[model samples]
Each structure stands twice: as C-alpha cells, then as structure tokens.
Target chain A: SQQGEEDPQALSIQEGENATMNCSYKTSINNLQWYRQNSGRGLVHLILIRSNEREKHSGRLRVTLDTSKKSSSLLITASRAADTASYFCATGAQGSGNTPLVFGKGTRLSVIA
Target chain B: DAGVTQSPTHLIKTRGQQVTLRCSPKSGHDTVSWYQQALGQGPQFIFQYYEEEERQRGNFPDRFSGHQFPNYSSELNVNALLLGDSALYLCASSIRGIAKNIQYFGAGTRLSVL
Candidate 1:
C-alpha cells in the first residue's frame, strides 16, 4: 500500500516562477524524502527531511515537514525548463531499521519557457 | 564513483516464461532494493537484500524472488510471467549505517510481458 499521496496530480508553471507541491502520508515516519524522475528513467534524490526537522533548503529547493499533521511540502524556486519532471515523496517508517520506502503516486511538474 | 547499475535495459518475454534482471550496487553500498513501476504510477517496493540475505520484502508473491552476491550485486527473477507484470523494474542501493538511508538508483530494466 502507498503511504504518501501528492496533491495536484499535475502542475504547470512558467520558467522563473516558483512551484509548490504538497504530500501527505498515513503513518509515522523516520524521514521524508523527495525525488525527481525524468522521462520514466531512474529517480534522482532531491532532498530529505527527518522527522525531527521542520524544514530544509538546498540550492533552489525548499522542503517543509509537519510531523504532527503528517504532511510535507516541496517548493522549487526560479523554476527552469530543466526542472520539468515527476516529483515523488517517500517515507521511511518509524522504528523499521532501514526499511523499504513507501512512495506516493507523485506530482508531474511542467515548466514552460 | 560509479552509481547503481542494471542490465538488459529492455526485455520482452512471453506469458508463462521466466526472466531474470541483474543489478550492481554503487561502490561501498551494502544493501540493494528492487521496485516495480507501472505506467502512470509510483514505484512499488518488491524486496531488499543485505548481507547476501533477504532482509525485507514487500507484498509481492512467491513468483518474485531475488538473490544477492557477496560482492553486493543482485538479481531479480520472476517465474510464470503474466501480462500484468510488464513494467519498469528499478534497483536501488544504500549503506545500512547511513542514518537517512538515502538510496541511489539505476536507470532500471523495462520488462515487457506479452
């Protein structure tokens, strides 16, 4: 079963505009991670936020996690056409020593120039 | 360092036939995990191997089996393939001691069961 569900199944925005994607999960998690996949290929790890962390930033990406609400959000600043891809959120279960991640259906993002 | 790698980038098999997929983990990684992803869907966990043993598994059936070698390479074998089994099979590798267990992925093998 999938543990996380990404909102706005798809999103389209102009290049240079910021894009926001949200995700909600059902069970407690040790960490929440975001990954990007291009054209059905291998996934690239984007960012990871632990349960103890509320937010984190990397380059143009910003991630926020709300453990109490069981939700997380990813924001990409100054989006570029290169950022066009499917974004997924995955959760590592609490107390399950390095267990397989439970993934969401994902949100497809399109950046148009 | 070379990242995770999977072989037979694409495969076609008839129903009821058996198929095997291979994966080589990234340097220094000790754990390998497999996932199956259908069109327009997220990747579903198949199983994980560590120390050359099956450490964890998902809700897949017995037809889905795997083996890990001492060198941290792995193989995913499926028997009596069904049409619905057609999908992209992904291999991920990570170090067990890493706190976040960040997984490195490969391009994946696309299996087409006819």
Candidate 2:
C-alpha cells in the first residue's frame, strides 16, 4: 500500500507565481524526499528533508517537513512553464536500511504563461 | 557520469507471455531498484537488489522476479503476464550505506500487455 498521499491532485497557476503541494504519510519516516516527473518519463530528484530537519532548500525549491503531523510540503517559487510536470513525495521508513521508497499519487502541476 | 539507463523504451506482449526488461545502473552505484507505475498512479516498488542479492521485495507475486549481475546491472522478468500487468517500468540506482538513500531514476520502459 502507498504510505503517502498528496493533496490537490492537480493545480494550475500563472507563470511567476508560487505553487505549493502537500503530502501526508501514515508511518514514521526517516526522511522525506520530493521528485518530479516530466511527461511520464524518468523522475528527477528534487529535494530531501531528514526526520531531524524541519526545512530544506534547493535553488527555486523549498521543502518543509513536520514529523508530528507526518506531512511535508514542496514550494516552488517563481514557477515557469517549463516547470510543468507531476510532482511526487516518497518516504523512507525509519530503520529500514536502504529499503524501497513508498510513493504517493503525484500532483500534476501546470504553469500557464 | 552516465545516469541509470533502461532498454526497449516501449514493448507490447500478449497475455501468458513472458517478458524481460533490462537496466544499467549509474556509475559507482551498487544498488538497483525497480518500480511499476500504472497510468495515473504513483510508482510501486517491486524490489531492490544489492551485492547481486535480492535484499528486499514488495508485495508482488512470484510472477515478478529479478536478477542483479556482478556488474550491478539488473533485469526484471514477469511470467504469465496478465493484461493488468501493463505499466511503465522504472529503474533506479543508488549507493548503499548512504544516509540519505536518494535514488536516481532512468526513463522507464512502457509495457503494454494485450
């Protein structure tokens, strides 16, 4: 079964605007990572936030994690049309050394010019 | 360094037929993982291979099996394929013992079972 569930199955926004997507998980996670898939192709690793960490940033991407709530959010600033893709959130179980990731149904983001 | 790579970008097979999908891990990576993504759904973990051993597996049945070579490359084989087996197969590579365990993925092979 999928551990994480993403909210706002789909979202649309104008270029230059910010887009936010949230994900909730059922189990305790050692870490939470976000990935982006383009046109159903390969997924690109975006950012990762460890359980001990509350927030992280990579270029235009910012990620926040709340262990108490078992949820995470990805914020993309200054969105561009090129940013259009499906964003997914995956969780690594605590103490599961190098285990497979449990992914949530992705959020399809569309940036219109 | 080259990223993870998979062959036969697209494939078509009939029910009850067996199929094999191949994947080459990224350089310096010692682990390879496979995932099955149905349309409009997230990728489902199939299994993970490390040290040429099946270290972990998902809830898939025996029909889904895999082998990892000494070179760290891997293959996913499904026997007696059913129409429900159609999906995009993804291959991911990562280094073992890494704290983050971040995975690098390859463009998946789209399989269609008729």
TM-score to true structure, per model? 0.98, 0.99
Best by DockQ: 2
Question: Which stretches of candidate 1 lie above 4 Å from their native place?
Answer: none
DockQ of 2: 0.79
Q: Score the docking of each candidate (DockQ).
A: 0.73, 0.79
> lDDT per residue, candidate 1, A1-113, as tens digits?
78879998999999999999999999989999999999999999999999999999999999999999999999999999999999999999887547898899999999999
Tens-place lDDT per residue, model 2, B1-114, is 799999889999999999999999999999999999999999999999999999999999999999999999999999999999999999999999998989999999999999
lDDT of each residue in A21-74, candidate 2, tens digit only: 999999988999999999999999999899999999999999999999999999
Instruction: Count clashing residue pairs per candidate.
Output: 0, 0
TM-score of candidate 2 against the unseen true structure: 0.99
Q: In angstroms, how far off is A18's CA in candidate 1?
A: 0.6
Give the fraction of native contacts in model 2: 0.69
Model 1 compared with the native: what TM-score? 0.98
Score residue A30 of candidate 2 by CA lDDT.
90
